[model samples]
Target: MKQVLGSCLCNRVTYACENNFSQFHLCHCTQCQKATGSAYAANLFTDVDNIKWLTGEALIMRFNVAGRSISNAFCGECGSAVPYKSLSGKALVVPAGSLDCEPNIQPQSQIFYTERAPWFDSVTVCKKFDSMPK
Candidate 1:
């Protein structure tokens, strides 16, 4: 199995995981939106044991929504999302943007579509740019 490296925005935390992912999901749940501070969250799932922390494990912080299965793990220094074990402890959920390279699988489905943010309608409908418009 191939391994892909991942790190936080400030590089405070780093890890490696198998490039083989079981599932990739674009989650539109309200809880996910709030946790990610975005319209949706793109996540990759793999076996719980597939990841190895390379450094800064102590700088990681986690938050679990009260009375919900939702959870998030991030770097304390830069607040960048990283990988975290599933609440059930069965899988590792990787924030797609954390990876140094690309995952082998594309997003398979959108979960909780009904809960998607109203302003998230058709991202393609907006102007496309290689960089931020001045």
Candidate 2:
């Protein structure tokens, strides 16, 4: 695998990671949902050593949710989630949306499925639109 580039929605923060992810998980945990403001969080997990910040390092802010190991990193300018090491310091968690290139692999698992939002299960059946509906 080669290095993949990533940036924030505002393009103020950029990073590169060696494509060495060991797992790709779509976390359906409530915390993940809240952090993403969506049904689930698509995260790619890898060793922290594989990540390298390319620019706007000082614009990144991180917070640890109370009473949970879950932590979130985002660009202060645009509030787009960015990669951060897990609270345990063992792995880096990259929000799949932040990647500028497709990951070398696909999501391997849906974790905490039972805790997923009620509407999440119906998403696949929802209407598809290339752009916002008129």
Candidate 1: pairs in clash: none
The TM-score measured for candidate 2 stands at 0.96
TM-score of 1: 0.97
Could you give candidate 1's per-residue lDDT for residues 1-134 as a string of tens digits?
88899999999899999999999999999989988899999999999999999999999999998898999999999998999999999999999999999999999999999999998887869989899899
lDDT, model 1 = 0.95
Score each candidate by Cα lDDT.
0.95, 0.93
RMSD of 1: 0.8
- Estimate TM-scores for all models: 0.97, 0.96
Cα lDDT tens digits for candidate 2, 26-94: 999999999999999999999888888989999999989999889999999999999998999999999
Deviation of model 1 at 61, angstroms = 0.5
